[model samples]
Target chain A: MSESNTPRLPLLRFVYDGLRQMVRGRVVYWSWIGLLLAGILVGGWAYIQQLQHGLVVTNLTNQVSWGFYIANFTFLVGVAAAAVMIAIPAYIFHRQDIKNIVLMGDTMAIAAVTMAILFVVADLGRPDRIWHMIPYIGNFNFPASLLAWDVVVLNGYLLLNLGISFYIIGCHYRGCEPKLKLYFPFVVLAIFWAIGIHTVTAFLFSANVGRGFWHHAILAPRFIASAFCSGPALMILGLQIIRRVSNYPIHQSVIDHLAIIMTVALQITLFFVVAELFTEFYNETEAVMSAHYLFVGLNGHDQLVPWIWTGLGMLAIATFIGTVHPLRRNLLLLNVAAVLTVIGVWIEKGMGFIIPGFVPTPIGEIYEYMPNLNEVLISLGIWSIGLLLFTLMAKAAIPIECGALRAPGIPAGKLICRPEQQAPEYRKEPVNGESES
Target chain B: MTRYAMVIDTRLCIGCGDCVVACKNENRVPAGLNRDWVVERTSGAWPRLETEFRSERCNHCDHATCVQACPTGASHHWGDTNVVLVNPDQCTGCKACIAACPYDARYITPEGYIDKCTFCHHRVEQGLDPACVATCPTRCMHFGRLDDPRSRVAQLLRERNGETLKPETGNLPNVYYLK
Candidate 1:
C-alpha cells in the first residue's frame, strides 16, 4: 500500500472518535443543560407573574394588543417553514449531501413550533382559559377562523413530524431502511403544513378588510417569500455550527448551494416588499396614508422609521454578502450574513409587520406602544427555551449523522465501537503532526 | 326590524369625548378600553392648521371580516338587529378578530373575549338610542333605523353626502359620516 494512502480510519471510527471527545469534555453538555434549566425556571416564574397580574405586565396597551409574544410567534413560524426548503432538495431532488442534513430541518421545525405555542400561551390574557379553543367543550370556529385553523395545523404538523422523525430514528437504530412508502405521504403533508402555518398567519393580518394596508391579496405571497429566505438562512447557520462543534463533515458545496437558495428567496422577498410599498405609497387614499405614516414616519411616531430603515439596510447587506464571491464561502461572513437576514426579517415582519397597520389608528390617532421589561424578559425566556430545545435535539441527531450511530445490517457489536465514538474527539485534536492511522 | 345605523356631522363634532364616556358607562367597559372613541386630526401647518374630529365604533359591517376571522365563532352579528356581539364564554382570546378588524374597533377584554361596540343592542331592544347618540351634547351623532325610511339616519344619508369608513374595503359599514 502507498504510504500516503495508509488505511485511513473507517468512517465508523471517525464518528466514535468525535463522541469521545465531546463526552470527555462534559462541561459543554452540562452547561447547556444548566442554561436550559435556568431558562425554564425564569420563564416559569415570569409566567406565574403574568398569570397573577394579567396582561397589564406586558407592554401591550389598548393601542398595541400584540407585543413581543406575537412577534416571536411570527418569527418562529418562519423558522419552521425553512424545513420545506431542505426537504425539497433532499426528498424531491434526492440530493445525497442533503440527506444527512434533512433531519436537522425537521428537528428545527419541532423546536420552532414549540416556541410558537409558547408565545401563544404568553400572549394569552387569561392563560387558564386557553382550553376554550377545544372542539366540543369550547366552540372551535372552524374553517372560518384562521387562528383556529392555525391551532389545528400547527399541532398536527408538530405531531406528524414527531411521528415521522421517531419512526426514521427507530429504523436507523434497528438497522432497517426507512419505509419510504409509509413516510412519503407525511412528507407531502409537512410541505403543505409548512405553507399552512405562514399562510394562515398572513391571513390573520390581511383579512382585516377595514385596514386597507392589510387588505391585499399579495400578503400571503409576501409571507411565503419571507419564510423561505429566513428559514434556510437559519438552517445553513445551524448546519455550519454542527460541522464545527461536532466532527460531522458537511461539504462546502452544500453551504454554497444553501446560500444560493437564500439569495433567491431574499430577492423574491424584497420584490414583494417593494411591490407592497408601491401599492401603499402610490395610492393617495386616507387609509393607505396611515400605513405610509407608520412606515415613512409622517406622524409623531418616528421610532418605527429607524427600525424600518435598519431592517432594509440589513436585508441589503445580507443579500449583497450572500450573493458576493468568497464572502459567501467564508463561514464567519456567511453566518453573519445569514443571522443578519434572519434578524432583519424578524424586525421587518415581527414589529413592522403588525404595528404599522394599527398606526394612524383606524380612527387616525397615533398611539405609540413600547414593550416593558417584563415583556422583554418573557420574550428572552421563550427564545432561550427554543435554543435549548434545538440544542438537545441537535445532540441526539448529530451522533446519528456522524455515523457514530449505526444503521440496520451492521452487527450491533461492531456498530458500538465504530467511528461514531471517535470522530468528535479526533476532530478537536490539531491535525498538524498527527499521523493518519 | 331595527337596522341600527349612526350618522355624524364632522362640523358639529367638537372633540369633547362625551360620546366615549357615555358609551363606557353604558356598557361598563373597563378602564383603558373604549367601546366608542373619537379620533382628532390636526393637519396643515402654522396659521392654516385645521383640526377635525371623527367619532367611531363598530360599523356592524354587512360583510364583517371579524366574524369570519373569529376561530371560536365568538364574534357574530345579532340576527335582524344590526348589532355585532362577541361571546366571552366561547372566546379563547386569540385576537384574530382584533387583527382582522380594519376599524381598530375590536379589543381584547381582560376576560379574554373580543369586545367591541354593540350599538347598545340591549337598549335598542328596549326602544332606546345608544348612549353615545343620546348623550351627544351637540347632537352631532344621530342614531336610528336605516331600514325605516322615515328615521333620521336614513334621511341624513339621503340628504347629505355621507361616507362610510373604508368603503373600498367592501365591508358595507352601517355607520356614516357627514362632512
Candidate 2:
C-alpha cells in the first residue's frame, strides 16, 4: 500500500463496484439467472442420488464403463480450447473490433475450463479421492499416464486465462491500458496453452490402445479441427446474444472473423472424417470393428449409426451455408449455421465418439450403454453452473470494459454507469468533479 | 523372480462353469458382476464349425496398459510377482485402467474402486491353488510360477505351445490357453 493522496483501498472499491454491478440487472437478467439456478437445484439433487447409490445409479457397466459424463467432458474441453481463436487475432494481429470483445473470449474460457474440471469430477466413481491425483500429496503417475498430463495442462490453461483476463480487466477498471510487458508474454503463452489443453484431452482418449476406435493418430487433429468448428460456433451465438441484450458494442467484424475460422475448420474436420472412414473401411480388419458399429452396424446393432449420420448431415449443411458468402454474411443464416455446428459437434464428439469405443468390447461382445436420468440431470446441472459462471464474468467484464465502473481514484474518465445500473449511489460521477471525501 | 501364470487346457476342459462359481464364492464378487467369465467362441463355416468354451480372466500382462494408464498409480504392479492390483485407498475410480485393459478384465466395484482378478495371490501365498483352480471339475486350469522350469505351467507352455489372447496387442500376457 503506497501512501497516496487518493481515497482508501482502491482494490476494495474495485471489488465493491464489480459486486454491485452483478446484483443490479433487469427482470430478463434475473429470469435467466433464475432458470440456471433451478437447473442447479435439480442437478445437485440428482448428483446426491448418484453419491448414495454409487455409479450403479447410472447405466454404465463393466462392458461400457465410461459413459455420458465422460463424453460431455470430452466435448467441453474443445469449447474451452476454442477461446484461442478469438485471442490470436485480437491480441496478436491487433484487430480493434475483436480486441473490444477479446475479454469475452477469455471470460468464456474461464467458465469453460471450470466446467471441464467439474465434469471430470462428476465422472469419477469416488470424487472424494480426487486429491489422490495431485502430484506431491498423492501418488500421481506422471509421464506414463496421459490422464496425469491432461490434469496438469487443463489446470495450467485455466490459471493462464484467469491471470490474463484479470490483469486486462483490472487495468480497464483503473482507467488505464494494461502494460504489454507485464501481460503480453502471458497472453502469448495462453495461445499455445489453449492448443495444448485440447490436444492433451484428445490424447486422454487416444492413449487407450485397447479402445481401437479412439486409438488412431488422427484423433488429435480431429479434436483441434472440431474445436475450431464448435468453439467458434458457440462464440458466434453467445456474441449475438450479448449484442442484443447489452449496451456493450460487439462489432459485426467479430462475427465475420469467427464465421471464417469455423468455415475452414469445418472443411478440414470433414476431410479428417473422410480420412478416418477410408482408414476404417478400406482394408477392413478386426481393428476397425468399432467403426463398423459406428458407421453402419455390426451384427444387428445400429444404435449409433443414426446419430453419427445426423451429426455429419448437420456439419455438412453448416459448412454449405458458411461457404456461401451471402448466406454466411446474413445474420440469420450465420446464427443458424452456428446453432447447427454447436449441436452437431456435441453429438459427434460427445456420446457418439465416447460410447462406440466401449460398445463392442475388446474380445467382440456388444454391450450397449444408455445413460439414465441421473446422468442427464447431473450433466444439465454442470452446464447450468458453467452458463451461470460465464454470465457473472461477462456481466462484470462488460461494464468494466465499457468504463461504467472503475477504481474511484483514477483521474481519467467519468464513472458513467450503464442504463441498467440505476442504483442511487452509482449515479454517474463527473470526470471534472473532485473525488469523494 | 516368480512370475505366476494361468494355463487352461481347452482339450480336457468341459464347459462346466465351476471356475466361475468358485471365483464368485472365493472373492464374493457382486451378484451381477464377475471377476472371471466363460466365453463360448464358435468360428469357421457351418459344416466346419469349431467351437471352444474359454474361461477368461485377467491376463496379468508384463506390459500392463492398466498400470500405465492409471493416473494415481492405484492400478499398479505388485512387487516381485508383478501381478497387477488396484490400491483402493489411492484409487480415484477414474476408470482409465478399465479402458486400457485389452482383455476387458477390470470392473468398477460396488464400493467405487476398480476390481479385477488378482490370480489369487492371497491363497497362493499359503501354498494352495486358487479356489477356481482347486474346484475345476476337469482339472483343466493350472496356476504356477513360470520362472521355475519344473512347474507344470512352464512345462505345458513348452510342450503345447499355448497361445495368449490378442497377442497382436503386444500386452505379453502371462495367462496361456492350450488348444
Q: What would the per-residue lDDT of candidate 1 be over residues A35-91, giving only the tens digit for each residue?
A: 877877787788777878778677776666776788788888888877754687778
- Which stretches of candidate 1 lie above 4 Å from their native place? A1-25, A282-295, A400-410, A413-437, B9-18, B39-54, B136-142, B149-152, B155-161
For residues A302-327, write the lDDT of model 2, one tens digit per residue. 98899989999999999999999879
Here, model 1's chain A TM-score works out at 0.87
The DockQ leader among the candidates is: 2
Predicted candidate 2 versus true structure: per-residue lDDT over B1-179, tens digit per residue: 56899999987778889999999999999878888889888889979998898899999998999999999999888887768888889888889898989899998988988889988878988999988899999999999999999999999999997999988777889889999
In terms of docking quality, model 2 is high
Docking class of 1: medium
**What value does the lDDT take at residue A87 in candidate 1?**
81
> Candidate 2 regions off by >4 Å?
A1-7, A412-437, B46-48
Model 2: fraction of native contacts: 0.84
